[model samples]
Target: MFDVQHLSYQAGRKPLLRDVSLQARPGELLAIVGANGAGKSTLLRLLSGDVAPSDGLVQFDGQPLASIPAAMLARRRAVLTQQHTLSLAFRVQELVLMGRYPYFRGQPSAHDYAVVADALATVGLSALAERSYPTLSGGEQQRAQLARVLAQVWEAELGFLLLDEPLTGLDLNHQHHTLDVARALVQRGFGVVAVLHDLNLAAQYADQVLVLRQGAVVASGVPAAVLTAAHIEHAFDIAVELLPHPSLDCPLIVPRPRAGVGAAFSL
Candidate 1:
C-alpha cells in the first residue's frame, strides 16, 4: 500500500500543499480531482518521490520513500508526467525500451524486448513501434509514454503508477481506453493514482476520490460521497447539475450556466 501522512510542500516560502493525507491500496485506483492550480500535480510529485515534502511522510509498503534507493524505486513505481520533451530523436520502441534500463542496464535481454512489445500492444501503438517519437501526434506520444511507464513496473510484486493529467492530449476514445488500462492494472494488484480533470471519468472508474482546493484537501472518499453537487460547485467555483450516468450508477456532472448570465457569456 502507498501511504501519505500530513504531507505538505512549500515553494520558496509559498505553500503548495497543506496537511494532505491519503492512502492508495494495491488493487485499487485513487483518482485526484480539482481545479487547475489546485496542487493536484504537486501531490502526485510528492507521492512519486520526485520531490520531497516540506512536512510529513510518504511510504510505500511501509518503507519510507526517502530511504528507498533510486534504482529500487524505479523498479517499484513508474511516473507519467503531463509534459515530456525529447531533444534527441529516438524511435518509439527505443523510448519504451528505456523503461527496462534499470533492470537490464545498458544491454537488453529477450525478456526486456518481450515486455516492450507487450507494452506497445497494450497502448495500441504496436504499429508505430518503429516510428520516431517526435513524428507521432500529441495523443500518440502520450500513449507511448504511458506504455513506457507500463513496461517499467510490469513484473513488480507491488507496483504503483503515478499519472499526472494523463488524459491531456488523448481523444475521447483514447481517454476511455487509457483509464480502462489503468483499471486493468488495479486488477493485477498494481496501485494507480491518477490526477484527472474529468469528474465523470473519476466517478466511473475510481474506487476512491480526493478533491483538492487551494492546496488543501477539500474532500476524500468514495466517488459518490466526494463528488456531490455542492463539492463540485465549491471546488471548481462553477454551478453544475449532477445526474446519474445513463448506464453506470456513477454521477455525471453537467456544467450549468451561472444565474443571470447570458448564453454568450463564458462561465
Candidate 2:
C-alpha cells in the first residue's frame, strides 16, 4: 500500500502541490485527474521518488519511499512516463530485456528471458518481439514500453505501476486494452496509479479518483461520489452534464457548450 501524508512540493518559490494526503491499497486502481499543470505529473514524480518533496511523507508498504534501496525498489515499482524517445535500433525483445537488468549480475538468466516473453505476450507484442524499436508505429512502441515495465515488477510480492498519460498515442481499441492490462495487474495485487485525461474512462475503471485543481485536492473518493457535475465544473472550469452510462455503472460526462458559444460555430 502507498501512504502519502501532507505531501507538498515546491520549485524555488512556486508551490506545485500542497498538503495532499492519500492512500492507495493493493488490488485497486487509483486515477489522478486534473487540467494541464494541475500538479498531476508533479505528484507522480514525487511518488516515484524522482525528487524529494519539500514537505510531507511518502511510504510504500509502510516504509519510507527514500529508505528503500535503489536496487530493491526497481523490482517493486515500474514507471511509464508520458513520452518515450529511443533513437537506437534495438530489437523489441532486447528493449524489453532491459527491465530485467536489475535481476541479473552479468547476464540475464533463463528466467529473465521467460519473464520477457510473458510480458510481451501480456501486452500483445509477441508478434513484434524481434522488430526494431524504431520501426514500429507509435502505438506499438507504447505497448512495447508497457511490456518493458511489466517485465520489471512481474514477480514482486508488493508492487506498483505509475503511468503518466498512458493512453497517449494509443488508438481507441489499444487505449481500452492498455487499461485492461492495468486492471489485470490490480488483480495480481499490484497497486496501479495512472494520470488520466479522459473523465469517462476514469469513471469506468477507477476504483478511487483523486481530482486536483491549482495544486490542491478538490475531491477524492469513489467515482460516483467525486465525479459529480458540480465537481467537474469546479475543477475544470467548464460546464458539463452528467448522465447515467448506457451500460456501465458509472456516470458519463458530456461537455456542454458555454452560453453564446454556439453562435461562433454558425455558418
Candidate 3:
C-alpha cells in the first residue's frame, strides 16, 4: 500500500500543501479533487517522488520512497504527468517503447517490444502504432502517452499508476476511456491515483475520494460518504445537489443553477 504521514510541501516560503495524509491501496482507485489552487497537482508530485516534502513521509509497502533506487522505482510505479509535448517526428510505437528504458541496458529486447504491443492494445491504439505521434488528434495523443506509462509498469505484479489531470483537454468519450484504463489497472492489483476535476466522474468511478480545499484535505472516504452536498459546497464554494444515479450505484452530482446564466434560445 502507498502511505503518507503529515505530508507538507512548500515552494520557497509559500506552503503549497499543508499537513495531509492518506493511504492508497492496491485494487482501488483514489481520486484527488479540489479547486484550481488546491494543491492537487503538488500532492500528486509528492506521491510520484518528483519532489520532496518539507515535512512528511511517503512510503510504498512500508519502505521509504526516498530510499528506493531510481530504476527500481520506475519499474514499480509509472507516472503520467499533465504535460504531453513532443515536437519530433517519432512513430507512436517508438514513443511507447521509451517506457522500457529502465529494464534494458543498451537495447530493448523482444520481450520489451511485446510489452509495447500489449500496452498499445490496452489503450486501443494498436492500429496507430506506426503513425507519427504529432499527427494524431489530441485524444489519440493522450492515449499514446497512456500506453507509454503502462509499458513502464507492465512487468510488475503489484505496481502503481499516478496520473495528473489526465483528462484535461479530452472529449467526453476519451475522458471515460482514460478512466477505463485506470480501472483495468486496479483490477490487475495495481494502485491507481488520479488528480481529477470532474466530481461526478469521481463519484461514479472512484473507490475512494480525497477532497482538498486550499492545500488541506477537506474530506476523504468513499464517494457516498465524502461527496455530500455540504462538503461540495464548503470545498468548491458552489451549491450542488446529490441525486441517485439511474443505472449506477453512485451519487449523481448536479450543480445548482445560478443567476445571469447565458443560454441560446429560439433554436
| Span of ten consecutive residues with least summed lDDT in model 1 | 258-267
Model 2 C-alpha lDDT per residue in residues 211-236, reported as the tens digit of each score: 99988999999999999988899899
List residue ranges in candidate 2 displaced over 4 A.
262-267
What does the lDDT come to for candidate 2? 0.94
What are the Cα lDDT values of the candidates? 0.94, 0.94, 0.93
Give the Cα error of residue 228 in candidate 2, in Å.
Answer: 0.7
User: What residue runs in model 1 are displaced by over 4 Å at the alpha carbon?
Assistant: 260-267
Better of 1 and 2 by TM-score: 1
lDDT of 1 by residue, 167-202 (tens): 989999999999999999999999999999999999
**TM per candidate:** 0.97, 0.96, 0.95
Query: What clash count goes with each model?
Result: 0, 0, 0
lDDT of 3 by residue, 133-246 (tens): 989998888889989999999978889999998896788988998899899889999999999999999998899999999899999999999999999998999999888899
- Residue pairs clashing in model 1 are none
Error in Å for residue 23 of model 3: 0.5
Candidate 3: residue 258 lDDT (0-100):
76
Error of 2 at 94 (Å): 1.1
Query: Local error of candidate 1 at 76, Å?
Result: 0.9
